[model samples]
Target chain A: MAMVEIRDARKVFDGGFEALRGASLDIEEGEILALLGPNGAGKTTLISAICGITQPTSGTIAVGGHDVVKDYRAARNLVGLVPQEVNLEPFEKVWKTVRFSRGLFGRKPDDALLERILRKLSLWEKRGATIKSLSGGMKRRVLIAKALAHDPRVLFLDEPTAGVDVELRRDMWDTVAELKREGVTIILTTHYIEEAEALADRVAVINRGQILLVEDKDALMARMGRKTLRIELDEPVAEIPAGLSDYGLRLEDDGRVLVYDYDTSAERTGIARLMGALAAEGIVVRDVATSQNSLEDIFVGLVHDGQEEEGVA
Target chain B: MNWAAVAAIYRFEMSRFFRTLLQSFISPVISTSLYFVVFGGAIGSRIDQVEGVSYGAFIVPGLVMLTVIMQAISNASFGIYFPKFIGTIYELLSAPINFLEIVMGYVGAAATKALFIGVVILVTSSFFVDLTIQHPLAMVAFLLLTCVSFALLGFIIGIWAGNFEQLQLVPLLVVTPLVFLGGSFYSIEMLPEVWQTITLFNPVLYLISGFRWAFFGLSDVPVGWSLAAIALFTSLCLTAIWWIFRTGWRIRS
Candidate 1:
């Protein structure tokens, strides 16, 4: 069975806003799944339903083969959640805060385990300090330590690096990688495309309370990812020549560079034919380079496509 | 039963109570002592006794009931309210524990805190007056029942309230006035015939009268009626709490 299974879950708030509209997904054990979406795209709502913070209006969610609503205790016991907000008791000590989470999950007091987690998150020295006294990054670390205190089988990190600094964000990525290596099933939601690109085995895109696509990160990139070929010219051109007009190339950098976008999966890229046409026109090419599109481009394109579909609907 | 989770919440709340020692422990003691000085000292000299007991001693149970009710309500309300206000309640909601365990932890701690304050006030009252407990067990029972019942009421209020002002609305505007009008400082027998019947309708009167009977073997209402009144009040509070949890009324959304 999958580690986490969500089957056609729906959430309609009291104000008649449908936050989640029949979203379904299955996350395997020992792999990281990154949920990417725009704001209010139901990424957090879907996480909330799985974590039992909010009940779904319809359908079901199960964690570790136990239904989240029917068998909430067992389901909740196996899952840990790190919410996006930094909501800790201001006067609470870091050690007590982490220890309390373990106890809340019906776990016995394990000081050794607690120590290991705090140390792993670099929170050992600050364990004695109050939450309010710590820096923002340290407080975020405390949240991670709390989530790991019970040694849960699956973990959910909702926008974990939303406001974190560059150095701390890198540290968080390392922590998540280490957690995955330890065989924990991790689900993360992020607006930062690079973070998802770096950490996820599979990527799920959500927009407007619906799952747009769920596929292997590499496969998604290979299937839909486009490549750009940049041709740097030895001499500037006022306009595209009559012979090169059929190639649909864009003149950039004050006409010093001609850019062509092509699909990698296409059988004929037309790059060679374009080169011949340039040569027939007697254009000298100083240098040539090809670059693949980053995940950001694909993400933006997907969301934009979703928006256009909504507009058409 | 998720006892570890219960204990975790209980200890966390108790630690906060202890952390604010001056406000939680000392302030109530000092305030109760002042009430004794004003009602028991200044007024006791003018009025010799009520129902053959010294005026100072007669008001002891009433004063303790007053403090216990307020403490129970405020402690439990604040215990739950602060978490909701600060948004730490998400952890509790997402935990493996059920609502029963959540209530046991919060209400148990609130009752314990109120009981402690009640005992302290009783001891402090003895220093100012010649005091004796005719039935110590009954006194303890009354005190315990009052703490638990009022704490349950506070828990409901905490869940119902949307802001700090609404949180304090009940304990201040409703409960405090009822306690005072319920004859906490004087017996209903001293009131006119019509008003005595009116006082009999006040729920807090039964608690105070039963508690006074425990102290001095004297009560404005029959001992059986007092016990019955408290039993009904406790059951009502429990029912309200059960409904709140069942419907996920205010705590879950």
Candidate 2:
């Protein structure tokens, strides 16, 4: 069974705003799944429902095969959440803050485990410091330590590195990677597409309160990711030659270069054919370069398509 | 039961109480002493006695009740409110523990704090007046019940309040006035027949009357009525909390 299973989860706030509309997903055990979405795309709401922080208006969510609503304690016990907000008691010491989370999960006092978590997050040296006294990055680390204190099977990081410095973000990525090595199932929501591309095995895209798509990160990129070939001409031409019309190439740099887009997975990219056609037309080529589309392009395209569909509807 | 969770929350809140030792402990003690100087000294010089009990001795239960009620409400309300305000309440809500356990942690801690202050006030009052307890066990019971019930009420208030102003609204406008009119410093019998009847309508009056009975065996109302009044109040607060959690009210939303 999937470590976390969300079946058609829907959440409507008090103001009648539907935050999650029939969102369904299955997160496998011991894999990093990145939930990618724009703001107000219901990422946090979905995490909240799974964590039992907020009840869904309809449908169900289960963690570790236990229903989040029906068997909340068992489900919640297996999951730990590091919320987007850095909310900690200002007067509370880092050690106590982390220890409190472990205790809140019905876990027995394990000072050794807490110490390990704090040390892993580089919080041991600052354990005696109050939350208010720490820097922003250190406070975020404290949140991670608290989440890991209970030794949960699955962890949810909601925008864990949203506003951190580059160094801290890299540090958090390493921490997440280490957690995954320990057989922990990780679900992270992020606005940074590169973060997902770098860390996720599977990528789930959400938009306007619905899951747009869920696929293996590499598969999604391969299936939808496109590559562009840019050819620099020996001399400038006013426009594209008619012979290259079948390739659908566009002239750029004042007609001195031609750009062709093709699927990397295609059996024949038509690049050789286009080049032969260009030579047959006496179009001298100077240099050629190929670039693959990044995850950001695919993400933007998906969200844009979703928005356009909504607009049309 | 998630007893560990309860203890963690309890210890967390208690730590905050201890962190503000001057405000939590010494302030109440000083305030209790000030009340003695004002009511027992100034007022006693004129009235001398009320129902054959020295005026100084007569207000001890009232003073303890006043401090206990206020402390219970403020401590419990702030204990819960601060988490909600700081957004740390998400941790509590998402924990494996149920609402009952959450309430047990916060309300339990609040009551404990109030109980401590109540005892301190009692001790402080003794230094100002010759004190006697006609029913020591009953006094303890009343004090405990008051602490618990008021703490529960404060929990509800903390959830209901959206801002600092609203947090203080009930305690300032409703509770303090009710306590003053509930015969905290003077007996309801001292009021006119019409006002005395009106004073019985104040729920706080029963708490004070029963508490006074434990201290001096003098009560404005029967001890049974006082006990019933508190039991009813506690039940109402519990019912409200049950509905709040069931409906995913302010705290959950």
Report the number of the highest-DockQ candidate.
2
Off by over 4 Å in 1: none
Per-candidate DockQ versus the true complex? 0.90, 0.91
Which run of 10 residues does model 1 chain A get worst, by summed lDDT?
Answer: A304-313
Q: Could you tell me the C-alpha RMSD of candidate 1 in Å?
A: 1.3
lDDT of 1: 0.92
Candidate 2 has which clashing residue pairs, if any? none
Residue pairs that clash (backbone atoms under 3 angstroms), model 1: none
Worst 10 residues of 2 chain B by lDDT: B17-26
Against the true structure, what is every candidate's RMSD?
Answer: 1.3, 1.2
User: What local lDDT does model 1 show for residue A93?
Assistant: 99
lDDT of 2 at A167: 93
- Residue by residue across B1-253, what tens digits does model 1's lDDT show? 9999999999999998888877766777798789988998899888888999999899999999999999999999999989989888989988999888999999999999999999889888878889999999999999999999999999989989999999999999999999998889998988999999888889999999999999999999998999999999989988898898777787766
**Each model's chain A TM-score:** 0.97, 0.97
